[model samples]
Target: MVSYYHFQRMNKALPDPGSWDEYFETFLAGNVVWGSWFDHVKGWWKKKDSHPILYLFYEDMRKDPKREIRKIMEFLGKNLKEEILDKIVYNTSFDVMKRNPMTNYINEIKMNHNLSPFLRKGVVGDWKNQFTEAQNKQFNEYHEKNMADTSLDTHFRGLS
Candidate 1:
């Protein structure tokens, strides 16, 4: 959510809140641009099997990008050599994307990269640094309530 906040701020697409908490409150109220995250995800999750949707988790991708890439390849019905898959993994890596203007938003006229890079610290569980204990507890409760009906697990192990 911090990343999304930064992106919106950098692009001047939304009004700035006084602090992260303010933005988070707005997010919790489902006043965000795309509506509630749980609603959006749950909607997709429901029709995923019926549609050509391929739901990919960031944690799964970060854990084994090569494996994820192979899944993507198979999903697209493409048969590429192992060497090409290796190249795809390397080119799509965080560091590579951060340096590549084409992949990063470095050249985007609306975005102010000086405020925050489009690609910040690309690590799992970075939210730990942003959320206070109180906020964390509140968020967890909110998340539990919102996600009660869905099988999606954002808190799957190995986040760190």
Candidate 2:
């Protein structure tokens, strides 16, 4: 869901189209987003037991940073101190990451900060505000049809 919103936002500055509907149609028609991601994640998920693949959901991590970080550390076989974990949580928090010029990619591409700040609102459900009714309908239809067989948990079911 957030990925959809990210794409929609990216479409705003891209040379794809003027309107959201047209932009979405063009982007989806290109088949870059879903095709690449599905193939990559599906491959990783397929060899989960054989390889060290821990499926991490963004929503789950956002909801519980400490728990998620601990899970990640465990996956990597790293048992850091509690204070260090707390420090990691504070340093990697959305606000800190967004504020840190080193972490944010605003300077890497020489993007004008006045026109676009690298990191926008780091929150879930922002897609509901951006996606229009017709856009949602189209996206839902396309997603339902294409992702019916995959195990990718998109969590995208229209707006509400």
The per-prediction CA RMSD against the true structure, in angstroms, equals: 2.1, 3.5
Note the residue pairs that clash in candidate 2. Answer: none
lDDT of 2 by residue, 75-139 (tens): 99999999999999999888999989788766524444554456777786677777788778877
lDDT of each: 0.80, 0.68
lDDT, model 1, position 35: 86
Q: Model 2 misses residue 72 by how many Å?
A: 0.6
Candidate 1 lDDT tens digits, 39-111: 8888988897689987787878889999999999999999999999999999999889989988887755667
Per lDDT, the best of the predicted structures is 1
TM-score of 2: 0.77
Task: Determine the C-alpha RMSD for candidate 2 after optimal superposition of all C-alphas.
Answer: 3.5
Point out where model 2 deviates above 4 Å.
Answer: 1-18, 31-44, 47-50
